[model samples]
Target: MNSVQEGRVALVTGAGSGIGAAVARKLAAQGAQVVRADITATDGGVVVDVADPRQVDELVAGLGRLDVVVHAAGVDDPRAKQRIADALEAGRPPEVTASLDAEAWRRVMSVNLDGTFHVLRAAVRAMVPRRAGTIVVVGSSSAFDAPAGYPHYAASKAGVHALAQAVAKEVIPFGVRINVVAPGPTDTGMAARTPAVLRQAFAGLPYATPEQIADVAVFLAGEESANVAGAVVLANGGRFTV
Candidate 1:
């Protein structure tokens, strides 16, 4: 790919591993100065929990000059996953809303939804002053497709997608483009830990590599996608026809 992002400054959250790490690597390769942020910092990355608004604000403010931002930090509650697994084992559907664990739900939302807001808000504020920026938020197909027994994950991602769309409209006038990439099942450490029954939902389908998803994110962040805004680019391998 071309170094279309030459000389730009980019920030990618959740850069410790998985898709976030891939995105950070790709952005750097495209000639951008990439700042990697995560709860657990690595590779000279800044340590910050996106769920904390103050930390996110500090991270972006310290960047000095921001042009591209990719919000990929998120979590699927392990407690909820355990509940779903136990349900499946009992030959029953996963726990419904009534029986869902409140703490688990809040944990997922804090990171996946609230965290996204903090990062995106900080990035946009920094970019609005310059009137030139692009943000790519990593969402999930579960937002639209609704995975069984994972309300917290689904709700958080759905909120993320909506947040991107709403913010995209608000910032376009200031030359900032915010978009979402809703990927389906991907080959990542997070996916590897999912219960077997849940994984089988995409049995016949091939899992997407982190690099593949990163490619889409990079495209959205570059000049090639200049006209695209408030769009959710689905990279779900044809799992959902709609």
Candidate 2:
């Protein structure tokens, strides 16, 4: 709602929909020259996958002056999701090690962990030279709680949290800050795709709207959170305290 980001340049991954789209919109509305990058074309965003290093480089190069980076592109392991539903319906935690297929695990890790690294690496290259920028990575409550079966997703996000902390430490001397925002079960299409029972279980806990998470992200990207670095802000409304 404020114009703190006026003249800033922000690049948001997965901006085609859900929380990414919300963050992109929030940054733009706050007067940042938002480059809404994603894999799919949405109403007000550009299309680019953070997983591709070349694409990430191109996107940053096009920005001319990259000020902020919000890495939000990620995926859940499909096999784990299915197994979790079956296990929950049977009243037990799914045997992820036995049930999850390799492909599913690889897919989730590639998009969530590797993709995050790609985006952050590109952002760093673009920002370090100018010695000014911020990076807000989108982690998840699951990274802390790590629900029963989604090991791949949890592991990837955990890596994200760690990476953010490391980045913050390594880049502070360059006048760059890196942080993470872990949102709870938000009302989004991604949440809708979760099994109904799983959704209900998460719903029973505190949940925030996409806008709320966006607010936290924007704060991390702005000078308002200047003292905040190597920190992970849990936006999960008390669901998971990490």
Candidate 3:
């Protein structure tokens, strides 16, 4: 409940559930004028599909001005952990490319990679004019150490991290900072889709809750990390070091 972000206009994408929802709530609780954006409407946010450039543009326009942008919208297509396990059991490689359907790959890419880009582009377009803003991209540990059977998701998140670094450099002179927060296997709907056996196998390792990731995002958006830029902070409970 810090008042540091009070009166700032913050926009969070994919805010209907999971990490996105948590980030949105965290920002709002800190007194920021939060504009929760997602494709599906919820009690605290508006519906917005970040993959759609036009929608992103319209959202920024509706906000008039934005000081913080948090991109968290993502999708896991054909979420069937059993199918993944079955494929592996049948000697098929445990890789997304080994068995991921064409539509599934496309869906994941569109939502996670393209969606992040669209939101970032829109945020930059608006923030550059103001010459002051911050952006926090919600990446995943998979970007650094991808597990088997989820190449699409991993690759897309890797793109997100790269984009954040590039944008951080490009916008630094504009008084805007951009960074990423990569969370490990988090306890969210996305993680719940994994097979029970696989989940159990990874149970010993620490899994972060959505709130912990959200707190990191808040730090990135606030002024405390003023000198930080082009950085990817890992909130994975020691799962990956970078």
* Candidate 3: stretches off by over 4 Å: 78-80, 87-96
After superposing candidate 2, which stretches have Cα over 4 Å from the reference? none
Question: What is the alpha-carbon lDDT of model 2 when measured against the actual structure?
Answer: 0.84
Best by TM-score: 1
What is the total number of backbone clashes in candidate 2? 1
Q: TM-score per candidate, in order?
A: 0.96, 0.95, 0.93
lDDT of each: 0.90, 0.84, 0.86
Root-mean-square deviation per candidate: 1.5, 1.7, 2.0
Worst 10 residues of 1 by lDDT: 76-85
Rank order (by TM-score, best first) = 1, 2, 3
User: How big is the positional error of residue 52 in model 3, measured in Å on the Cα after superposition?
Assistant: 1.1
Give lDDT tens digits, candidate 1, residues 160-224: 99998999999999999999999999998898888887677678899999999999999999999
lDDT of 3 by residue, 1-242 (tens): 55988899999887888898999888888898999887887886787887788888898988898999988888874464566676666777554566577888888889899998888899999898889999999998889887677788888999989988998999999999999999888899878877776667567787788999999999999999999999999998886597
If both were scored by TM-score, which would come out higher, candidate 1 or candidate 3?
Answer: 1
Decide which is better by lDDT, 2 or 3: 3
